[model samples]
Target: MEEAIFSKLRYMKKVLLIGGAGFIGFNITKFLAENRNYEITVADNFFRGKMDVLLTDLVDKYKIRVVNADFTNAASFDQLDKDYDQVYMLAAVVGVKYTEEIPNELIRINAFLALNTLEWLKTAQCKKVVFTSTSECYAGTIEAFDYQVPTPESVPLCIDDITHPRFTYAVTKMLGESGFMNYSKVFGFECTIVRYHNVYGPRMGFKHVIPQVTQRFLKKEDPFKIYGYDQTRSFNYIDDAVNGTVLAMETPDVSGEIFHIGDMTDELKIEELIKYIGELMDYKGTYEYESAPSGSVSRRCPDISKAQKMLGYDPKTSWKVGVKNTIEWYVNYINTGGDVFE
Candidate 1:
């Protein structure tokens, strides 16, 4: 008789990481690999993620395994093991402006992947699931700062009622969260939701605000040309987000509960952030400011009280520290003339 799938792991703790090659996924997998407690299996398709980011040398050294797969493909699902103690779904077409332009494709990919995972999760006996959702699922606001930042999970989602441009990303995220929650309710999967706010750090795409600013500065051109000076976002360090995700997984009562994960203390302005990056890079360039696009939010901050209260989650990395680290990575990447996409 054939051995049961995941049976080899009965004597050892193991975790399944979907999209484990992405920025956040790579960091989480790296943490798990170093701790050496859990055998890690990472599945990714390299869509928005780069395979090189996971560092094959580290993978080999740590005995981490990778499966080239996309969640949308049924054949891909066939390759996945039927048993895992924990499952983390971090696969999605990410980014705000990028997701906005391709709303239909975004919805289809996210929805299909959620459904596919639901099927696989039904057959697999896992202790808990960590699902990453975005704060974009929250309703659009005219005054992000005047109102409580980091809107809580209890805040009503306004995606269904909006006719605005940014709603494309918002609506789909809401649907994805709903699908996951429903499956957990009916099928009894222990699920936890983390709505991440502007998660950025090493390995993140250069297109994100921080990297974008750094890149422009490195090019010896104006770094503040792209958007309005008023726009703002509370950047959450990737490590902080990863820690919160693991915490969510560990907390048993968080089954079917949603929490926003981000740094609540800092709210940096876009123009100011750019200037800071330029200073870090020591770039002498003209600051050319422009009006932000229509879809840009004036401000966005996470209310992380629930995360702190429920899961004992707190962001230890300050914005200055996170930015300094990100800037250092950008400088090295630029010095080597490494292609961000490569």
Candidate 2:
């Protein structure tokens, strides 16, 4: 009986996470490792993902397989097994800075990454896949056409300016969404698309708004500049985002469907977010209002009713509470001389 049980456990469903070392991917890996018994493999090029202590610790504890290879090259797919039960495509060059600095490279890397993965899936016997997307894809729809505030998955994806560098990331994501969904249709596999809002939490790297705010407060900038102070966003905590993604993958009969995985209830202004962080950091700093960066969306909030109704998905973290937890973690990390990774 003992030998039989061990054999069954060893042959359980296998899950693959492409680009699993990044902030959201790593959190999803951790969640699955803690809650499920499935065999998990994390394949990442680490372009932005780091092979740091946190990741190594999880790998060691759970015996999770980590594959370090550039998935941009079609040849790299040869390194992976063809029989994965579920695959999470979370790989991308994601950051506003990168869009501004190297839009060409961002386009090249993200487009090739999605195309290569889709081609690989055409032949691989993967059962299901979740292609992670972003709210940026529909930002132009809202800005140009003034679409619904709590946007739904059906909203038409548009880019305000194709010539602008800021839209580079959105363009590639649009490609991924179309490629993954259509490929799965013709190729006879399962596929779901999830567009995430501003998902923030601990260990999310210093490139995002929350961490950048934390770093500024740590430096004690006297007049804290609040860019896009009036612009609104619904920030989803990392844990909630991970839960939604898992549900999208595990829930049946949801293939070819797109779900907006974000907290619709936590919408707040950029000013409110910055001021709250200041209060948390105990900084007596004055505020400076500034214009939002060019091409930035003025407002973004997802309509997650579909997810809630279909997958029973609900986000539990209030922005204030989530922000507090994130701030505490960043403060502790910085105080302990934590070097920036990713």
Candidate 3:
């Protein structure tokens, strides 16, 4: 019986994770390697998320293959195996900071990554593809058109102002959504889209609000500034996001479908989120409110009912529990003087 079990493990599915070095990709890779007998290959450029000790440990433990290449270049896909059973396309320049600083570069890199990968799939023998996306693609629709809260995937994507640098990220994602669905239909590959909503956790680097807030508190900012304090968002813990993503990939007969993978439990205000983080950090500082920049959606949350019904996706982490765990990790990481992010 044990020999039979080992035999099954030896012939597990071959999975390829493009940009798997990043936060979401890394977690997904880890989950699959430990929880399932998957022949995993992580392809990454490490432009934003670095190959830190954690990912190195996982690769070593799982015997996973690592391909280091900038996927922004069209020919880079050749370095990867065309026979992968599954592909997770998570490569892209993310974060609001990048959008504001280098919108043109964001558009260029993201669009090319999507297009190049699509062209590769046209000939590749992959059975299914899961393309990671963000809810920002529909931010303008909800804000401008007053779309339903816990916004569904059916909400038409909108660009409040194409000229605004922030919308550049959304524009490229919109292109990926349209391009991948259409390309899959034409090219005969199973594809699923999971739009992540405010997914956050430790080792996600210092770009996001939670980490930024922790840094400010640790720096002893006497007057803590809560930007977009009144604006609200529903935060999805990384574990929930990873699970939903895997479900979208593994579930049967779900091709050409879009699922909003996020937590709809708490639509907390920005000020509320920051204060909770501050409380965890034992912050006794004063607080101030600041305005969100242009093109920033005032309110956003995904209606995850579709994912719940179709994929059996349910978010299990609460803001308090998730925030506590995240704060602990960042605090320990900072206190240890780890220069991994640098």
Candidate number of the best lDDT: 2
- Candidate 2 lowest-lDDT run of ten: 4-13
| lDDT tens per residue, model 2, 97-138 | 999999999999999999999999999999999999999999
- lDDT, model 1: 0.79
Model 1 stretches with alpha carbons more than 4 Å out = 1-11, 141-147, 160-165, 222-226
Q: Candidate 1's residue-wise lDDT over 1-342, tens digit each?
A: 246645544557778889888888888888778864687898989887676735686678888888887789766888877777788999887766655577778777877777788877877777688888887766354243244555778876654236664666667677778888888888777898899998999878777878777777767885347477877778899899999998998777889899999988988888777777778888775777689876666777888999999999999999899999998987898788878752
User: Higher-lDDT candidate among 1 and 2?
Assistant: 2
Please provide TM-scores, in order, for all candidate models, with all chains considered together: 0.90, 0.98, 0.97
What's the true lDDT of residue 283 in model 2? 91
Ranking by lDDT: 2, 3, 1
Comparing candidate 2 with candidate 3, which one achieves the higher lDDT? 2
Worst 10 residues of 1 by lDDT: 139-148
Candidate with more favorable, higher TM-score: 1 or 2 = 2
Q: Each candidate: what lDDT? A: 0.79, 0.95, 0.91
lDDT of 3 by residue, 225-320 (tens): 888888999999999999999999999999999999999888999999899888888998899889987677899888999999999999999989
Error of 3 at 185 (Å): 0.8
